[model samples]
Structures are given as structure tokens and as C-alpha cells.
Target: MKQMLAWQDISRQGAHQGIARMHKAHRDLLDTIELAGRVRSEHPQISCRDIHYAARGQMPRGRDWTEQLLLSCGFRVKTPPRSFTVAGQGVCANLIEGMSITGANQLWQTDITYVWAGRRWYYVSFVVDVYTRRILASHCSRDLSSASQIRCLSGALSRVAGQDLSGLIVHTDRGIQYTSGEYKRYLESHGLRHSMARYAWQNAYCERVNRTIKEGYLQHYTTDSYSSLAAGVCRAVRLYNHSKPHRGLPCRLSPDQFVKELNQGLHPDYRVNIWSKLTSTKMLYVN
Candidate 1:
């Protein structure tokens, strides 16, 4: 009775676009997101500060309050809050900037991105082959934990039965999941040379793939359930790897076709390494 009396003055706003409109009694989650949606669509790289700067007077509340609301709406500022830490010798020095990653299994870049399905948020982590531009593997989980990353890598490795991975390198940002003791041990056990990017741009390949998967594919199938979203990601990946022809590939072959032709020696320019030319023209920031 006391709890009921305490909330008697508050009001419940009905749902909007399948989401309940949050207000003072709730924290303005929906309205803040609605404004943020427009800002994000215009500028995917926009930060929380930028959003606040753009929508100054119209914000639901103060900076922190509005930021929290935006976060709940799956809007992460481009600037990650965590400070970079070096493991062993140095992470920045081990970066792939100058390395000759010419083969499919030679270099694998990894990153995690948040996807919204209805009110719930899902973390989708993927590993991309730097050479072939193939999505080697991906794992979708509720939380962005190291376990999920490990699962993704494990699955990728299992599928590399006869592939030459002796010079394998795993590149990722300095997130806790990527830097944890367990993750480091896994890398050491697999004899994988791990590299960490000091700046976000250094890990561009995987970030670009994440954006492509989201905007190019997943955005169209925006549904209210996780299962539907997961299936959509799988279907999209298949289409991307098998059907979508890339201008970079010989005769504009899809990623899977590019690798298949190279294996069969049907690709005329198989000796040419395309790493230098394979970069996302547009800047990609983690959302």
C-alpha cells in the first residue's frame, strides 16, 4: 500500500513504435531515443556530447540524464571510455599497419557491436579475414563477454581444418573482453599473434563489416524478437559471402567465390595481395 501510494502521482505513457515512452517517472528513455534515432541516422559517428550539442534545448533533461537515456536506447558514443593498456611488449607496436597480411587465414580482425531488437540489446561479435574480406565467424549473445568472443574464435578455428594458420594474427581493440587473462591465454594456446589498436581507426576492417551488416542488411529486417534478428544476421551473411559480388575481387566475385576461385587457381591475380587497397573509404566509429 505504501509503495502504491508513493507512485500514485506518476503517470504511465503508452507505447510508441513498440516501445513505451519513458518520462520523468521512468527517465525519458523513449523520447530521448526518438530524438537520438534521427541524429544517429544522419551521423552514425555522432557521440553523446555531439548529440547533446545538436539537440541542446530539446533534450529531455541534463547531460548525464540524457546520455543515460540514449545509452538505454542502444546509442553508444564513438569515444569509448576505457583507457588503453599494454600487454607483454606493446599493443600499438604489434598492430597490422605494416604487416604483410596477404593470405585469407593470415590476419583476422575482430570487433563487437550492439544491435537493438525491440527493447532488448544484443551484442554481435565477428571475426573478418583481412585478405579475402570474408566473415570468418560470428557470435551473438546478450552480454559482450570474453566467453562470447572465445566462442566465435573457437568456431572459426574449427572450420579451418586444412587452412594454413601458422602466421595467424588476431587484431582487436583494447576492450576488457579482448584483454582479459582468459582471452590472452586462449591466444597463446592457439599460437595466435594478437594485436590491439590504440586508436579506433586502426581496427577499421572489422568495424566496416559491422556497419555493412547493420545498415546494408540487418536494418531492413528490424524486428521485435532476438530469434528473428539472429536469423536475419545469418541469412545476410550468407548472401554477402555467396551472392554479393565485390568490385575488389577478380570479375567482381563474392567473398566466398573469391576464395573458391583462388583455391582452384582460376583467379588470375591470386598472387597479388589486396590488403593495401582494402580499406573502408568512409570512417567507421563503434556505435
Candidate 2:
């Protein structure tokens, strides 16, 4: 109740858009509690700070309130994780920038990567909505099976339910899962186009994102149980969606914000693929 009052007080001083953003932030904060609980149960060994950092994704305000709340709940909230894998050698073998965007949702990229869960190896598959830099779906499993890929893909599709995905171009590397007949039929059934990145650079955007998750997000903590990794990934997804700022979007807007603005009839300042032209002195070029 006190937290709600404080939130309302802060929100009252802002513009309508600012108030809306605050409301959204408050809602997201509340939602993170449930997400954090599920994550902590699955990955029981993750620290409260680690989970909180993953939930907020940036410098947190009103953190004392959170700490007190957790302490009241019998959870000890401590300092943030000191994982510096992002700067360590051999942690990431990919560069962070440089990718082409034809249009929004035009190119969806998929990939698989390996992570260490205890002494065993776990594989994770991710499907990213390339335009907004949002990870639509991800799943980690002991083995890379067509069923796993199907599950991830289905989750991604379900997130966009009731929407027209026609003309969507799905881009992926030449993985067997991507080239498999079942995957091909699924794409065809949805009237979605397909493309493959024959070279590693073609998929660099998703690669960088994956590296960020493994290094900045996942590798920062010591998890006593492998299930913690799954929880970490889920928490990471929520942060990635609602909190983390991407360089691609101005105002540090999240992927969810970009989508919301689009749905609310806000137009982008820069063009994605829409071309403009001025006619020449004597002629105009025609396609």
C-alpha cells in the first residue's frame, strides 16, 4: 500500500505520457515479482540480488523498499552480482553491432547455443524478432531435438497470436533444425518467407544478443543447480522485454514500448524500407 502511494506520488508530477510510462513501469515491477518467484523456484540457488538485477535490468530506484519487502518475506536481498564475463577473454567471440533491417518483423532470426549447466552441457534455442531486438521465444534442453525447436517456434508464434504474420521473413543459419522438413512445412503453412545466413556475419545481431545473455546476464552468478539457468533465462527474457534499453530505439524505449507505440498509431521518425524520392529534371525512374 505504501509502495502504491509512492508510485502514485511520483507519477502525478509527470506529463500524460510520463504518467503512462510510470504506470507501465509500476505494472511491470509488480509483474516481475511473480516472474521472479517462478524463476527462483525453478532455479532455487539464484541469489535474491541476481534475480532482482535480472528483473529490473538497470539501476534500480526505491531499492530499499524492495530490500525491505524481501526481508519481510524472509528472503535476503544483497549486493548485485559481480559477474564480469562481458569483459573477460574468450567469453564472447562476436562483435556487438552492424546489422541490416529491411523493415519491422521482416526478418526473424533463430539460432542455437551451448551453455554449461553444472558439469553437463545444455543447449538453448532462441527465436528473435530482428526488427525490435526482442527475443520472441527461447528454450533450453539437454538435447537439440526437432521437438525442442517446435516448442520454441510455437511459443514465438503464440506471442503474436491473432496477428497477420504474412510476408514475415524468417532468417536463420543453416542448422539442421532450420532446414528440417517439419520446420519448412510450418513456415509454409503460415505463408511466411524464409532466408538463411550462409555466413556468420549475416546473423551477427542475434549472436551479439546471445552473447550478452550468456555473459552479462547468466554468467554473473554461481548457480548450485542447473534449473537455475532456466529460471535465469526466463527472468532475462522479461528484463529484455520490459526494462533493458537498446541502442536501436531512441528514448531508451524497450521492445514492448516500440510495439505499443506502433499499435497506438505512432509513426517512426526514420524509415525502415519505405523510400522517398525527388523527380529528376527530365525524367523519373520507374520500377
Candidate 3:
């Protein structure tokens, strides 16, 4: 009986010592976990990999370790909702497919998304520069009209006024606002080529911008009123352009930072060919 009591005491001491070591290890991780939490709070929809990249200066652990730590700390990562696209007739050809995109202003993509605010739905039109993945302009309205689209496009054009836009191609899905006579006339007057996607996937870049704005930034802001929604949209655009790190960009620089570096000749211009399965299949058959 004495020997049994001694064994039980030893087992209890071992368990306590193991728990103490675990507690100390967790205590040491408090600062890193807090920093990660702050990053996640600021960008609610950011992935764990991005969080680690953003906070790499302060984090001592690697990417996989950071992700595991976040999970163990009870940080629930939310997956974005799935999107579906439908085929449609297009008024213009897909000019960007398989085309080599080398720099900004060469190709711009636009799209519209609905945002719920003030107990109603508000439509927002966004124009993004494909090469830099930067949102150049956006306009919010109560209805999906060509007027809003024109205003949005006008804003984008005004930003680069006096620059040569004759070679610029504006891509969009086959939506009524983009196909309207007024919109087409505006594009012609501005000397911008009209490129329409027959399938929604053809305009993948702009579609991603829509999701980033709606899911990453706007969803976390107050939008109970029209004014709030407009303000939120503005704030989201600024954050996305100035701070959000783009994985596609060199060094994962933000859009604004990439533009700055490019202007300074710090980075070389690279060609990005538009991806299309049909184009690949056709090439294979020809070969």
C-alpha cells in the first residue's frame, strides 16, 4: 500500500511539471499572439499566411508555425463564399485573353457589386488597373445605371488625364451598363478600347477586386446609412490601395508601393499573359 501511494505521488508530480512547462511556453508566446490578433482585427478577412507576412518583423516563427499557433489560440479563419458565373453573349471580343500585359494603364477592368446598407441595396462600380491590381476609382449609387458606370469611368480617366490612353483596353463582363450606347460612346470619346468577357471568369481580376472590397474591408465597417456606406467604401479603397499586400506583386508590395517602385526603376516590367483554357487547347491542337 505504501509503494502504491509513492507511485501515485510521482505520477502527479510529473503531470504538474509538464503542465508548468506548457504554461511557461504559452506565456512566452503572448506578445506574438497579441500582435497577430491586432493584425487580424484590422483586416478581418486576411489569411493566416498574410498575417504572418504582415507581422514577420516581430514574429520569430515560420509560416506553418504561425498558422498552427493562430488555430491553437482559437482564431477562427472564415472561408470566402463560393462564386458562380454564367456564360453570356458579348458585344465586344475578349481582347485581353492571351495578350501580354506588361505595365499599368495597358489593361483596366471594371465591375459592379451590390452592397446592403440603410436597409436597401446599393450598387458600386469599381475600375481596377490590371497590371498593378490597383483600384483607380469607384462610385456608389442606389441603382445599377449606366450613369453610375460613366461617372466611375470618368473618375478613372480623369486620374490619368493628358497621358496616352489610345492603347489602353478596358475590360468588363457583358453587363447592360457596360454595353449601353452612352457607355460605348464614352469609351470611344476617351479613346479606350472596349473588351467584354463572354464568360464571367474572363473578368476574373475585377471580380476579385469586388470580393476584396466587399468581404475584406467594407463588411467590417459601419454601413447603416448611405453616408456611412460611402465613407466606408472610401476608407476601404484607401486601405486596399495603400496598405494591402498583393501576393501577385513583386515583394508582395501594396499597389501604391509597387507603383512608386516601378516609377523609380527599382523593379523591371514583366509580361503577364491572360490565362484562358480555350486558348491553351487551341494552341495544343495547332501544335
Candidate 4:
């Protein structure tokens, strides 16, 4: 009878310890969930992988675990809206087709996207370097005038004021704003070559940027007014150029980091061959 009593006490103690461990585990899971929520709140449009990377030190879990945690917490990615392209007349040839973009300023892509703010629509023009994947300049306006494109190009040119831009190619779609005489003259004056894409896919680099900025950051922002929208775009550009990690870039670095490393001669052999179906042989390489 004494031996039976001792066994019962030992089992009770073991059960209590098991219950304590379960409670502790529950507390730890709650803490991780809270941390993930905080990270999601900060970067509302980033992917689960990005959030997992962001919460590296705070959550000691792997990528798959973090993804599952986010999914369980109802933190899902929103589907992007459908985009359409307009056909227009262009005067220049596609100079970047099958070209290898090995350095910055060798090729730059520009595009304009529409943003609905307040009771009306606003336009945003962006000039992005194909090599670095950096948005060099952006202009937000109430109208889709050629002046906006000119201003955006001016801003980008100002960044490389002392550099020689003789053979630099500025590619864009067949939009009227781009083919306008004013915009063409501006490019000529700066000694920049003009390249036009017949289809939206041809300008994939800038098109991707347009979608990323609009859907990834701007859509998540509270832009009730034009001023608010502009500010939001500015903040989004800053974050994208500085904070966001690009998978295409070396080491999954941000645009600024990749440019910095490139300037420091870290990635000497890295090259990005522009994907072109126009060429007889497809040459799409990124290393």
C-alpha cells in the first residue's frame, strides 16, 4: 500500500511538470505571434519571407515556421489589381534589346503610373536604373503632362551631373508624354539616347517597379489627398531604395546596398543581360 501511494505521488508530480511545460510553450508561441504581428504592421505589403527576415533576431524560427505563423494569424498578401497598357506611336528604336547592363547609367527605364487619390487621379513618373534596380527619381503630379516626365528626367540627370551621358540609353513605352517633342529635345540636349518599347513586357523593368511601388507600399498607405499620396510615394521610394531586399540583386541586397557594393568593387563579375524576345537568340542572364 505504501509503494502504491509513492507511485501515485510520483505520477502526479510528473503530470504537474508536463502541464507547466505546456503553459510555458503556449506563452512562448503567443510572444512569437505578437512579434510577427508587429513586423507585419510595420511592413504591411511585404511577403511572409520578407517579414520573417525582418523579424530574424526577435523570432528564432525558420522561414517556413514564420510563414505558417503569419498565415495562422490571418496575415495574407493581397492580390494586385489588373493593369492595362495603351498603344501609341514612338519615334526611336529599341536600343536596349539584348544589351548587357553591367553598370549604372548605361541604361535607365522610365514609366508613368496612375494613382487615385482623393476624388481624382494622380500620375507618378519614375526613372529607375536597370543595373542597380534603384529608383533614381520620381515625380507626382495631378496631370500626365510631358513636364512631369521632363522633371523626372531632370532629377535623374542631376544625380549624375558630372558624369558623361553620351551613350546612356533612356528607355520608355510608346506613351505620348515620352514621344512629345519637349521630352525628346530634353533627352537630346542631355546627350541621352532614346529607346522605346512596343509592348508592356518590353519595358518589364520599369513596369515591375510601377507595380511594386503602387501595390506593395502605396496601396497600404492612407492617401486621402494628393499631398498625402505624394508623401506616401516619397516614403515608399525611400523604403524600397534603402530597406527592401531585392532577390534579383546580389546577396538579396537593397538597391542602395547593391550600388554601394558595386562602387566598392565587391561584385566585379556581376552582369545583367536584358531579356529580349526581339533578338533571334534569347539572352537573359543575371549574375
Candidate 5:
């Protein structure tokens, strides 16, 4: 017998005239997920996973059912895949795995993944602060271009314009935008160094951020346009940066909280740093 708990309880009742094959258990969960999302928006520190565990009384194994239901509703879900093919032929060092990141913006990683908006897929590029696990910048576009990449870089630079970026490193998998002449010039002009993962596995951190947003956040909401998805991305990043605690960090503090402590000259506090704002984005496509 497949013990879904409710079924087991029903059988234990001993007197059931008839049973409906489908129950509204999953349907009823929508309300819980919505409540969780609302709390996440306002509080940002309340973990959605914890909400699910409390709602379902146990963690459900497999994809988030809410996400699965949304996907079933006609959204083209995109997952970051292993890129076995070679990237733009370029020489760059690997900065994440073996390197020690002491603070925010010392090392930043960027990656572009697709998000479904309205009817078509839009490219979403994110620049993450490696030390704090904070999303410093994100932008979406109809086409994969250096412009999007530049915008992400620009956002990061704008935040730290007067500070020395000589020690900072921007890492990414070798892609056209990354390897393009213009992109290289921009990095050189800004005095920012470039780093590349030798293999797909080397890009794990950035990819994890991509998965976190697409699977953990995007899947929970139904977005119809690039603007909607972008706004959703903002909401999701805000929650993650302000709430989610990283195991690697000291005190298990959220990125924002950690960063705030560090910037106050609290040495050995093992904190993080920075505040970020997403740029306005609007674009739509239909399949």
C-alpha cells in the first residue's frame, strides 16, 4: 500500500463507502506556498524550505511540488546543464576552489541562464559576491550579448567605484561574451582581473546560484513577461541575500547581516558586506 498518510488514516477509519482517487492535498498546498512567499517578501529571513517542512510535516523528496505544478502550467523550465564543449579559447586562472575569499567583492562570479517570461525565454545574467553568497547584480535580455555582461559588470563597478579592485577577481566559464575583445578591454580598463573555470565543475558556485534562483524561486511564481520574471528575480535575490545563512560563513549569518558586521571594522567577526539594487529591465517574447 502506498502510504501517503492520509490514505493510511482513511483505511484505518474502517468505514468508508467510497474513496476519491485524487485528493486536494496538493491543491490545498498552494495556499501554504503563497503564504510562505508573502512572508519571504516581507521578512526575507524566513526560509521557504522550513515553511514547506512545517506545512507538509516532512520534506518532500524531488522537485518542489509548487514548482512542478507551475511548470505543468506551460512554463518552459530551463536547467543549467554541463557544458562539455570548449568555451572561447582563452587563458585565465581559476580563482574560486583553491582561493581564499576574505570579504565581499574580492571575488565575483557571473553566469547567464535562461528564464521563461510570458512566452519566450530571456537570458538572465547574475554577478554573485563569492565571499557573502550575495547577488551583487543581475540583468535579463532577449539576446545573449556582451551588453548584458557589461551591464552586470557595470553594476558591480558602480558599487565599488572608488575602492581598489586590484585584488578583486571576476570569474566565469569561458563564453563568447567573456572572451570577446570588448569584454576583455572593459576588464583591463577597469583594472579587474578575469578568471575561468577549467571545467564545468569548476563553475559550481555560480551554477548553484543559477539553480537556486531558477528552481528555488522562479518555479514558485507564474511570470508572463521579462519584466515580471526580472522582478521575481529581484525578490528572490533579496530574500536570499538578506535571509539565507551560509554554512561556510561564521555565525551562520545571512549575507547582508554578515557584510554589515564586517564593514563596521569588526575583525575576525567572519562577516560579509554590501548592498545591491537591481536595474530596471523590461522585455517580452512569445513562442
Candidate 6:
């Protein structure tokens, strides 16, 4: 009768294949564990429990192995730290609580964010006209340099050529891309006014646009097998700007719809003014 031996007690002659297989299994497991760590590091808000659940079908793994591998790879299983994020403050403070937009192309808000496709990262820069809530232009690239932002801004300017901007107030966060001297000089030459969000909320409008791209388009359109990050992002942006509804607008119109309305001069009774409502309530209370 043959006796069963513990894994550690296996001899080199008989255990070669089994040992090789076991080592390969451990390597794959460790690779997955390392990936989870990377994900956690990149998105610090993700929890161990979230990783465990996400790894289920993905890794053919059990919770205990997942936990042990994570621990062995120097990952601590922990609840994420509480986050203290607010929308408006710092460089974005002055831009929130209903910044008024008097005319088309008068105000543009811009921001940059990252997207992942397959295994690589990409960047998307957006320019949204505030008054009309229209996405003037968005560009996606493999790099997050100031050049990407400038390219997107240039595209937006080209898209709006011949459009008058007597009182334009272009707003953005204090991201280095927006604050670069090159970007500043470009805006100055175009005769556009600059306004930065004193608080994050000052950039809320742009942030919402970002949320739509990330949560709506990216989450739905992308999969693990995306051919390229740029392709995925470009497709996502095209879907969003042309098809998706804008919640900020009545009738749930898309940016394209809003632009159509603007070009037709169709919004005769539309409540374009934001300050009058606040002023009317104050007058009633005073009376």
C-alpha cells in the first residue's frame, strides 16, 4: 500500500511534477494578490471585502486563500479610512452655489481625469460650456500632460470659432494642467476671462461631466478586453455627448439637444437667469 506524504515531505524524484504545479499555482495566486494590492493602492477607498468579492469568479479563489494571499503579499485587510472630500473650497470656492452664465460660450469649465483600459491608463480632458451645459470638446490620450489639456482647449476654441464671448468666464480646478503658464498664455491671447474654482464645488459642473464619463459610459462600455484605452474613451465620449441626457436641463435633453435649442433661438421662455429667482424670493420676504 502506498502512503500519503505531506507536501513538504515529498522527494525530489517523485514530486517534481507536483512541486512544479504547486509552484505555478502559487505564482498565479501571488500575481492576483499583487494586482489587488495595486488596485487598493490606486483606489484607496476600496475595501478588502470588495476585493474578496471581486476576486471570486475572477481568480477561481476562495475567501480564505484570497485573505491569506493578500496578507502574505504585505496587504493588510482593513476598512478603508474615512474620506473628507467636499465639492467647493480652496481654488474652487468662488465657482459654486450657482455661477451665472449669461450667454452661449460665455463660460467653459474644464477638468482632467484618468481611465483604464485593459492594463494601461489613459487621460481624458474635457471642456464644457457652462451656460448651455454643452460639451464643447473632449480629448483622450495616453498621457496626462499639459499638452493634452491644451489640445482639448484648442479643439474647443476651434469648435466655437466666430462665436462671440464678450463676458466669457472660463473656469477650472487648480490642476497643474490648467495652471500651466502655457495654458494661461493661450487663454490670455484668446481674450477669455479666467476663473478658478476656489473650492472643488466651484468645479462641480465639470466634475459632474466627469462622473458621467466614469460611471456611466466607462463602466458600461468598457470590459477587461478593451482593445485600447483611447478607443474606449473616444467611443464613450461620443456616446455621451451625442446621446445621453443631461439631468441639469429640463426635458432631459442631451448636450446636442441644448445646442440645437440654442442655435434655433427656441428657448424664448426658458429660465436662463439664475439670479432672478434668488432675488425674487428675497423681495417677497422683505415685503
Candidate with maximal lDDT = 4
Q: What's the lDDT of the predicted structure labeled candidate 4?
A: 0.84
- State which candidate, 3 or 4, has the greater lDDT: 4
For model 5, the stretches where C-alpha displacement exceeds 4 angstroms are 1-86, 95-97, 267-287
Question: What TM-score do all the candidates reach, one by one?
Answer: 0.62, 0.58, 0.84, 0.83, 0.65, 0.59
Inter-residue clash pairs, candidate 4:
none
lDDT of 5 by residue, 1-287 (tens): 43764675756343233333133455445554565555445443334333443234333332276445434543333444433435877657765554655666788888888877888889888888777777888887888888789998898788667876777888888888888888888898887888887566567667778877777678777679878888888888887787665555665566787778778776464533321122215332345
Stretches > 4 Å off in candidate 4: 1-32, 55-58, 164-166, 278-287
- Please tell me which model should have the higher TM-score, number 2 or number 5: 5
Model 6 spans > 4 angstroms off: 1-98, 223-227, 271-287
- Tens-place lDDT per residue, model 1, 138-194, is 888889788999999997898786777896889998888887888889999989988
Better of 1 and 5 by TM-score: 5
| Candidate 3 structure lDDT | 0.83
Model 3 residue 211 CA deviation in Å: 0.8
lDDT by residue for model 6 over 70-159, one digit each (tens)? Answer: 667666634322212323323322332344455677678888876676687667778987766777888877776778888998899898
lDDT of each: 0.71, 0.64, 0.83, 0.84, 0.68, 0.65
lDDT of 6: 0.65
Per-residue C-alpha lDDT of model 2 across residues 1-287, encoded as one tens digit per residue: 45775777754344467878889778756665665675455334344544554456442444555545555665653433322111111121212123335446666777777788788888777888877778899898788776788788788889888876767777766667777777777878878776765555557667766765675567655644568878878877776677555656644466787777767767555333211223223443455
Give the clashing pairs for model 3.
none
Q: Against the correct fold, how does model 4 do in TM-score?
A: 0.83
Global CA lDDT computed for model 2: 0.64
Clashing pairs in 5: 118-224, 258-272, 259-272, 259-273
Error of 6 at 89 (Å): 15
Q: What is the lDDT of residue 245 in candidate 1?
A: 49
Two-way TM-score contest, 5 vs 6, winner: 5
